[model samples]
Target: MRRLKSVVTSAVLAFGALAATAGTPAQAATEVRYVALGDSYASGVGAGHYDSASGDCKRSQLGYPALWAGVHDEYQLTDVSCSGATMADVRANQLSALSTDTDAVTLTVGGNDAQFSSVVQACLTKDDAYCKTATDWMSYYATHQMADELAALYRDIKARAPHAEIAVLGYPQALSATGTCPVIDLGSAKRGYMNDFADALAEGTKAAADKESVTFIDVRDAFQGHGACGSDPWINNLSSGTEVFHPTLAGYIAGYYGELDGAWS
Candidate 1:
């Protein structure tokens, strides 16, 4: 990515010099504004290469939004997504970045609203019966309560960026039910619970997207064989204490950005 940045910068400088000397047509004075709003998944918590300017938000330059912005030079990214952000956080802290001039927006929320991370932690540490009960309750909340909250948040986002093309992203499960890893793999039942949680979130997100007439990018299956237990894991594990159970750098590519590339147009 650093090499790519250098190349793009040099090309842009050359292009500008040529345009200045040859009386070429001018490009837009400002790039198309793209705002990213959501929580840790949107902020790239597990991925390294953090932008220090983002502070504790840990916005990775490799996250889908940054990668998309890097490739599309005509677009300017205002990534306000932060780790531990909820719907409330987006509304209160992130929505200010949106407006009629905003050309596009990508959001990944609701998981934090459902407290899915805490649930995953509990499932990993607690007994099976407790895990089953907590997971089931959280799934129900995600499908029912969190869905409503998301729909309302979508309404607000649409109101703020009336002309923006909005895309709401769904979370991917980080573990596989039948797969195994040394000490890091989730038990089959725990994996089932985690998968169920992801499904419930997806179900709600899809329904809300349909309700608000926006695009919902379902990326659950995109990381199918790349879970923490898979042969080729893209999600971080216990070994990676930075942000365990979250997607790694490769995951932001193949699992997230790759899917967005197809649906974005």
Candidate 2:
């Protein structure tokens, strides 16, 4: 009778344990929705082919946003980045691109505000003496006014995507610090201004994001040895091809992978 009682007790305990396990609720998976916004780099202008259906937006399958989307299985992406977006574009135009359910957002802008294409064309047309003066003036304008505009844009993004993890992407080095484009002749002074311009814009971006308690992932350090001057060039010199001083495919991958690894991991 003692043995039978012990067996019954053990069976009862096991059944109770099984019942408890069965009654426990399963953990639900976390869902992430991503929205990408900004200018030509965000749209993957020089990296590769873009969505034909998207028109001048030129959003690419291989762009950083798409690369980020590919790695995160739980993320749903809505990319409305356009080729010629300005700071006003984010507040006025791209605001409509974001949804209330967005969990994460990323942006790259202000190069178009500098009128980069016009700068490059000016460099292509003018003599070296005049080109230096013109580029310097452009860089000064960018460093001063563009920084504030970029900050305002980030603020708008935060307002639009209230619940999202926001990141402001910085532009890679366009001209070589040590190397020169045969046509543009970006000397040390011009290169210094360009570097300063990029750095100022990045600083402004970080400050803006910090005000909103958002993350600012700096891509400059990640692309350190991969500028236009480096052996493994990320941004191509305009002289290299018609795409003219834009990121290569490998550059996009390096930048995107760095951002994803930092944000998601």
- Each model's lDDT: 0.81, 0.68
Cα lDDT, model 2, residue 37: 89
Cα miss at 262, model 1 (Å)? 0.7
**Model 1 Cα RMSD, 1 decimal:** 6.0
Reference-based TM-score, model 2: 0.77
Steric clash count of candidate 1: 0
**Highest lDDT model number:** 1
Stretches off by above 4 angstroms in model 2 are 1-30, 127-129, 179-189, 239-242
Put down candidate 1 lDDT per residue, 1-265, tens digits, no spaces. 4533443454344334433443334357587889999988898888677878899889877677876766566767789999889899899999999988988999999988788878888887898888888889988988888888899999999999999999988988877555576665567888888878888989999888988999999988778877887778878877777588789877777777766766884
TM per prediction: 0.87, 0.77
Please write out the lDDT profile of model 2 over residues 1-265, one tens digit for every residue. 3533443343344334433443354333475778888988888777765778779788876677766655454666678898888887767777787767778888888887877777666656766555566667766666667766666677777777788888778776666677656655666665655566566556656665666566677777766666675466778765666456678776676664455556667
